[model samples]
Target: MELRHIRYFLAVAREGNFTRAAARIGIGQPPLSQQIRDLENEIGTALFHRVPHGAELTEAGMAFLEVVAQFPDLAERAIRAAQRAGRGEVGSIRVGFTASAAFSPSVPRVFRDFRRSYPGVEMTLEEANSAQLVAGLRDERLDAVFLRQDTIAGDGIRLHVISSEPMVLVLPSGHPAAQREKVALSELRDEALILTPRAVGPTHYDKVVTACRDAGFEPQMGQIAPQLGSVINFVAAELGFSLVPKPMTQLQAKGVAYREIEGEVPIAQLSLAYRSNDISIALRNFVSRTLVAHRQPRIDE
Candidate 1:
């Protein structure tokens, strides 16, 4: 019969008396008795034995009561699932990030906060070069990506600058430039530079190259690393010099010296891009939380 009938039956079965059961259900005893009869008639069996003192369950009623007892918890769980899905708290979001973005305080902090706030949301992280991160976003394999790219080339993409910081140099600790707290970009003109390929992070690459050009020298490129973190390893190995986001200095790239560039501060950026038309609630929640958590004034509103 109806859920109310099952509930009414269960209450009567528990209380063992129609008057008390009706009192618990806030219904008149006569109506409750009639409804119980109606349920029995519908189910084709009696569910209670009418006794002088109170009602005892029939064999069928005992079986039915056992099943009805489980409904409350089941119904509660179903309702909770609906509420969680409505609130975008139950689902999976695949996120991509550049190695450099992983080191940025904002990125990791946002992830930690998101996990803590929405424990029901399944978070999968893909760490790759910026180019690969963008590709994952384009292929729809990822819901969002954090990267540094000179140009985002797809109409289907919506990109936002999540974090920004100045680029700092990573040199061998024994290098002559390590003697200075700050070194001019021009002073490193003759140094062999270790940099991630332009394809790996064109925006960051372009910024570094443009800063060098502004200082009046074409960079003497040396080793090419596939990932940003690897650039530091190259520096540690004394392969060449590298310029990375200031946040990257947090990494323990032993034997490497971190320094600020003199005169002007060149900017390094971490951006997030997702499908422009994606209407998933989970993705929207993540983006909004990130912007708010990092105190980055919401740009897209």
Candidate 2:
């Protein structure tokens, strides 16, 4: 009739004695006998034969045992599933990233570590610019994102800055500035600077512009690239110089050389963005692992 009834029946069937079954299952002998009688009444069939020494199973009881024996295992499996899900170990998480953030070593490292640790969790990844990723997070289409945005906050979106690295210069291999190991932002005044659209990553775009102005120059604008990678490719084509995060130098795009800025420069930041109200266990686990892996402090407040 109930799980307790099943458990008592199993205990009596296994022990084969009323008193022993009662002791095994932590109930009184009289109470155990009455429980078995009640179970048989519910099923409208006698489940045990009361013998002189103990009790034996009837034909119906044997059949019932065969079916209910599996309940314990099944119940255990169900409990395990619930526990795993509660701990964020066995659900799906949709994650997004910016084009440049993907190039960061920390991004892949965090993903690898999370996958290894929570193999039961399903992960889906998307690549987009910072704005689109933020939109995805806000719209609940994405559980988390790695983006190069430091100013986006509020409106139920939270930001956790993972790492910040100095911005570098990417120049055509044949460009005059490429000859120097490091170039100052002010020196690129006359050279047209290739860039992605300001909307693609306003923080990064503004950082470059502000850094150049701080260096006493209004950077000349050249052909615009649609994305971060295209900005590097255009630099390879000698369209113009591009300023990018130092980590992006790992792209190793041919015909382009990466150089550090000599004087004051803006640092590009990579942040993990998520819905402030998201209660997904998998997403929480992912955010925790990411912050730990990057040794970043929690900035979600």
Candidate 3:
């Protein structure tokens, strides 16, 4: 039997008459009676006793009514849950990001805002390299990701650029260059440098190398770190200095001093990446609201 049958049966049981029940349900008496009959037949039991003046519940009807009494509340809860799900307020979002992105306040601010707005939607954050984040997005293992814009490329992935800022050099606090407010790229030629994994994002790594090369000499690469946090930590420990996006400097690393890189090398761009074909209304709304809320500031400004 269909849902209407259960509803008609419940209505008739409550009203104790087919005519009034049908009226309440906006259906005619005959159709309501037929639905009740269908419901009884489907259940292989008679649910009512016919009387001259009105309908009365049978033993089976009494048990059925007790169970069906809960239906109205159950149906209401189910409908509300479905609506919340459709609104993207009651599901889980798997978000991936690089170590540097985690250190940035904007990323955490977005997450806090999202949680406050959709408390029912659980967030699972994964920290990885840009390459791994991109792969997770591509493999459908991640719902979305925050990473450098240069790391995201491919037809199916959509990128919404959130911010771009000038690159800064992180040096040991005791380093001589730390005294300068802005360090020229040429000055780093002979300095030991900490670099991110070249395989993580060849374009970004190349940009760093190329920027140094353009300054008239090749960089003396010292330590290679898999993640930006490690690179910054290494710099704090005086292992080597590294070039990082400005936002990363916000991270409190003892003994690490930040200086602006004085040159025309491209600034780091942060973006939200997700599947272009994603049809989740909640995800779309989250992305749109986040972009509107976190518009990038001009690097010079």
Candidate 4:
């Protein structure tokens, strides 16, 4: 009936004597005997044969023992499962990243650290533009996201800035500016500028535009690339020059060279985004782990 009944039954069956079982279970002998009798009545089966010196298993007792003997082990496993879930040690997390954020070493490092620390968690990764990644978070399709943005709008969305890097110029390998160790932004006033559209990443797009205007020129807009990687590809094809985060240099596409700006530089920021009210254990653990890996402060702190 009750769990106490199961314990009493197992103890008496193990000791093979009511007095000894009572001592083992730290209960009075009379109460133990009464509980055992109650159990037998409920099951309509005597579990032990009374003997002069000690109790022995009845035919029915043997059958019951086989079934209830597994309870202790099963109960232990169930408790462990519940504990792991409560600690956020098991479950799956869906993480989305913008194309540029994926190029940063910090993104992969966070994932690797999380996997090493919580091996039981399953991780799913998706790459998309900042707009789509934010949508995924709002739609509850993604638990968290890594993206490049200075600001995010709308309710129920939270952002944590991970790191910021200066933007660099992506130029054709044979271009004159590519040969220089540092290029001035004012010098490129007449060159066509390839850029990611504002709709894809407003913060990054605006930063580039403001930087150009501050340098005393309105940039000549040329071909537009939908993604950061495509910006490098366009530069490789000599379609136009573009500005990208310094980490983009790692792309190492042939026929493309990276040059630093000589004066005040535009910055690209990488941030983690999620629902403001998300209560998922996996998502909480992931956000904490990422902030720890990057040495960024947690939103709560």
CA-lDDT, candidates in order: 0.87, 0.89, 0.82, 0.90
- The per-residue C-alpha lDDT of model 2 at residue 160 equals 80
Task: Locate the minimum summed-lDDT window of 10 residues in model 4.
Answer: 292-301
Model 3 regions lying over 4 Å from their true place: 18-23, 26-46, 151-154, 263-265, 296-301
By TM-score, who's the top model here? 4
All candidates in order of lDDT, best leading:
4, 2, 1, 3
**Residue lDDT tens for model 2, 1-301:** 7889999999999999999999998989999999999999999999999999999999999999999998987988999999999998898999999889998998999888899999999999999988888889878899999988886856888888889988999999998888999898788899998888888788888988888889998989899888899999999998889899988988988899999999787899999988888888888889988997888754342
Residues 128-190, candidate 4, lDDT per residue (tens digit)? 999999889888999899998867997899898889899999999999988998999988899
Per-residue lDDT tens digits for candidate 3, residues 1-301, read 5556668888888889888888999988888788788888889999999787768999999998887877777888999999999888887888898877776688899888998999998889898888888899888999889887655555999887787767888899999989999889888778888988788866567777877888888889999887778888999888888888888887878898999877765577777889988887667767866786786432223
lDDT of 1 by residue, 1-301 (tens): 7888988999899999999999999999999999999999999999999999889999999999877898877889999999998888989999998888888878888899999988999999999888788788888899998887545985898887866788998899999989999998888898888888887788888888888889899998999988877889999999888788998899986798999989887898878888888887788889888878767666357
Each candidate's TM vs. the true structure? Answer: 0.88, 0.94, 0.84, 0.96
- Candidate 2 segments whose C-alpha is farther than 4 A from its true place: 298-301
Cα TM-score of candidate 4: 0.96
How many clashes (backbone N, Cα, C below 3 Å) per candidate? 1, 0, 0, 0
Best by lDDT: 4
Off by over 4 Å in 4: none
The segments of candidate 1 whose C-alpha lies over 4 angstroms from its true place after superposition are 51-53, 297-301
